[model samples]
Each structure stands twice: as C-alpha cells, then as structure tokens.
Target: MAMIVQARAADAGAIASLAEEIWREHYTLLLGEDQVTYMLDTIQSEDVIRQAIESGTVYWLVKEDGELIGYVAYDLRESELFLSKYYLKHSFRGRGIGRYLFDELKQVAIENRLPAIELTVNRENTRSIEAYRALGFHVLREHVGDIGGGYVMDDYVMQYVIS
Candidate 1:
C-alpha cells in the first residue's frame, strides 16, 4: 500500500525533519561542510519549515504499507506553481515513486487552474534534469539561486505548461 497527502500545519515538525534529512544528503556532494551546516541551520529550522508547511503547499510522507518514505513542498506564484523542494529517503530512490508524486502535484496545479509549473534543479544534477525532461519539463532558463549560505546553486529553471 502507498499513501501520500497534503500535510496540514500540525504535521510541520515531521516535514522539517524530512527536509533536514534530504538536504543533508543532497548538499553534501556540492557544498563544503561548514556551508552545508550553515545551510541546514538556516533553512531547516523549525520556524522556517513550520511557516512553509502551515502556509504553503507541502505534501508529506509518501508511505508504502504505512511506512514513511518521502516529501515535497511547493508554492503558487500567480498562474505558476513553484516547487520549493522535493526529496525521498535515500533508500527510496529509483522506485518510480518520485514520478508518481510529481504527477500528483502536477494534477493539483492544473486542477487549481495554474497555467504553468516551475522548479529549479542543480545544473550538475543530470539524473534529475533527465527525469524532469522526461516529464515534459523544458529548460526555461539557466540560473543560479542563493540558498542562504556562501554556496549558491547553479540550476536550470525548468517549466511545465499545465494548462
């Protein structure tokens, strides 16, 4: 069995924990230790995550047979949906769950009448880039995002037309 849902404010703490876990794994390869620590400290704090989950769109804990597996956070900007972040437990990758999760999110955006969806992914993350491309996301622009550390993410702004 699999379960995934839009988490309410009450689930904020758990969402923060999942974000911390994902960042720890994802940033280790591209950032220095101190920067990674700083990134986590600044971004994964209870205050920030609590606000994001409470006010933004956060889909919590993809579960199989009732076991926790992954999460995603997003925000709507006008007619566009911006993905804040997405992550699965390290062991859960390659199971095609990510695709299913993304599909659901896209439906949510379209059903809500959003015209487009956008997300930024690391330029060096070829695997994710390919996955996004496969899902009909086109590279709208090459860009960089400063994630509040000395480190900045070199990314591609990918867009999917949802209308």
Candidate 2:
C-alpha cells in the first residue's frame, strides 16, 4: 500500500535527491542533460526545497512499504492550489500512483476551499498531459517564462476546476 506523509525541513535533502534522480531519468530526453542539470541544481536544490517548506509550501513524500518512491508539492494561492511538483520514479509509472496522488490533491483543495488546482507542464510531456486530462484537467493557456540561464519554460498552463 502507498502512503503519503507531510514532509518537514529534514526531508529536503531526500526530496532533492529524488528530484535529481527522477529529473535525470525522465527529463534527459525531453530536456537536454544541461538543462536538467541546471534545473536540478537551482529549482530542486535542497536549500530551495527547505526554504519553500519553511515558507508554507506543502510537500508530501510518497512511500510504499517504507520506501520513498515519489513526492508532490503544492502551494495554496489566494484562490487556487498551485501544484509545483509531481514526480515519481520511472519504474513507478503505469501504476495508479499518479491518480492516487491527484486524489490527495483534490482533498487538500477541498479542505482549503480552493476552487481549482493549477499546474504548468512542459508542452512536450504528452504522457503527463494525458494523465492530467484523465483527471479532468484542461489547458487554460500557454506560457513561456524565462527562468535564468537563458532557458524559458514553454508549458501549457492546466487547471482542474473544483465543483
């Protein structure tokens, strides 16, 4: 059985390590090795993860049989939940883990009275986009934002409206 635990400051290192592993295995082809290295070093660093947790970004570590398998992180904005990260090990894909995690996200949104959950996914990530669509998410718009190092995130802003 899979379980979710709220991550603390102490878990930042674990999260960062998993992020590096997952990003390298999953994103290397979609985004070149250089970009993957840059993203893991900056956005998914232990320091940044720790800071985000301290700043009220909620993170949950997903575990199965006492082994960490993945993680999810989100922030409660004024009117919606911004899902910053949803990553699992490549071997853990094709199971129901993604949907299980998303169900948890829905519960959190309801508890917080958020009307929607939003996330940005790389436009080329067709598998993830299809998964999100299966969970009732729809594309709201396209976004291209510079994230330093001359790299711009070209993504589709997707949203799931809570009813």
Candidate 3:
C-alpha cells in the first residue's frame, strides 16, 4: 500500500532525487535530454524544492514500504488549487498511485472550499491528458510559454471543477 505524507524540509533532498529520476525516465523521449536536464537542474533542485515548500507550495511524498516513489505539489489560490507537479516512478505508474494522489487532492479542495483544481500538462503527454479526462478534468485552453533556456512549454490548461 502507498501512503502520502506531507513533505518537510528534510525531505527536500529525497524529493529532488526522485524528481530527477522520474523526469529523466518519463520526459527524456518527449522533451529531449537537454530540456530534461535543464528542467531538473533548475526546477527540481533541492534548494528549489525547499524554497517552494517555504513559499507555501504544499508537497506530499508518496511512500510505499518505506521507500519514496513519487510526489505531488500544489498551491491554494483564493478559490482554486493549482497542481504544479505530479510525478511517479516509472515502475510505480499504472498502479493507481496517480489516482490515489488525485483523490487526496480532491479531499483537500473540499476542505478548503476551492471551486476547482487546475494544472497544465505538456501537450504531448497523451497518457496524462487522458488520465485527467478520466478523472473529469476538461481542457480550459492551450498555452505556450517560453521558460527561458530556449525552451517553451507547449501545454494544455486542464481544470477539474468541484461538483
């Protein structure tokens, strides 16, 4: 069984490590090795993860049998919860871990009275887009933004409305 635990400052290193592994395994083919390296170095560094936690982004680490396998991060904004990151180890995918994480997020939304949960998924991430659709998320729009380093995130903004 997998359990989600609130990440603390001490978990920064583990989170960074897991992010690097998962991003490389899952995104290298789609985003290229260079972009993957850039993102992991810039966004998933230990310091960056720590700073995000300190700056009010809530991170939850998924653990099974005492091993860290995945993590999800989100921020509550006024009436919305923004899911900034959701990743699982390659071996842990397709095992309902993602759904378990989403279910937890929904409970958080209900507790906070948020109207919806929103996130942006890379346009080429067909599996994730389909999973979001299965979970009742709808595409709000498509957006492309340059994230510096000569790379742009071409993504679809998806939202799950609370019913």
Candidate 4:
C-alpha cells in the first residue's frame, strides 16, 4: 500500500533526487535531454525545492513499503489550488497512485475552500492529459511560455471544478 506524507525541510534533498530520477526517465523523450537537464538543474534543485516549500508550496511524498515513489506539489491560489508538480516514477505508473494523489488533493481543496484545482501539463504529454481528463479535468486553454535557456513550455491549462 502507498501512503502520503507531508514533505518537510529535511526532505528537500530526497525530493530533489526523486525529481531528477523521474524527470530524466519520463521527460527526456518529451522535452529532450538538454531541456530536461536544464529543468532539473534549475527547477528541481534542492535549493529551489526548499525555497518553494518555504514560499507556501505544499508537497506530499508518496511512499510504498518505506520507499519513495512519487510526489505532488501545489499552492493555494486566490480561489483555486494550483498544482505545480505531480510526478511518479516510471516504474510506478499505470497503477492507481495518480488517482490516489488527486483524491487527496481534492480533500485539500475542500478543506481550504478552494473552488477548483488547476494545472498546466505539457501538450505533448498525451498520457498525462488523458489521465487528467479521466479524472474530470478539462482543458481551459493553451499556452506557451519561455522558461529561459531557449526553452519554452507548450502546455494546456487544465482545470477541475470542485462541486
């Protein structure tokens, strides 16, 4: 059975390590090795993760049998929860872990009185787009943002309205 634990400052290194592993395994095919390397170094570095946590981003680590497998991070926006990162090890995909994490986030939305949960997913990530759709998310819009280093994120803004 998988369990979710709130991440702490002490878990920054583990989170960064997990991000490196997952991003390399999954994003290399979609974003290319160069972009993946840049992203991992800039966004998923331990210092960046710790700064994000300190800035009110909530991270939850998923562990099974005492081994970390995945993590989800979100921030409470004005009236919605903005899901910034949701990743699972490639080996752990195709199971119900993603849904489990989504369910947990829904509870968080309710508790915080957020009306919706929103996230931006790479438009090319067909599997994740389908999974989000399956979980009642709809595409709100398309976006492309330059993240420096000559890389741009082409993504679909997806939202799940909480009723």
Q: Candidate 2: how large is its RMSD?
A: 0.7
> Residue 55, candidate 4: how far off, in angstroms?
1.4
Q: Tell me the whole-model lDDT of each prediction, alpha carbons only.
A: 0.78, 0.95, 0.94, 0.94
What's each prediction's TM-score? 0.87, 0.98, 0.97, 0.97
Number of the top candidate by lDDT? 2
- Which 10-residue span in candidate 2 carries the lowest summed lDDT? 89-98
Candidate 4 Cα outliers beyond 4 Å, as residue runs: none
Pairs with backbone N, CA or C atoms under 3 Å apart (clashes), candidate 1: none
| Model 2 per-residue lDDT tens digits across residues 48-93 | 9999999999999999989899999999999999999999998888
Tens digits of per-residue lDDT for model 3 on 21-58?
99988899999999999999889999999999998899
On TM-score, the leading prediction is: 2
Per-residue lDDT of candidate 4, residues 19-47 (tens digit): 99999988999999999999998899999
Angstrom error at residue 23, model 3: 0.5
Evaluated against the true structure, the overall lDDT of model 3 is 0.94
Give lDDT tens digits, candidate 1, residues 1-163: 4568767777667767776777778777766568767866777666677777766656566777776677777887887888867778878887888888888888878877998889998888887888889889999999987776467878899999985
Backbone clash count, each prediction separately: 0, 0, 0, 0
| Residue 61 of model 2, lDDT score | 98
Off by over 4 Å in 2: none
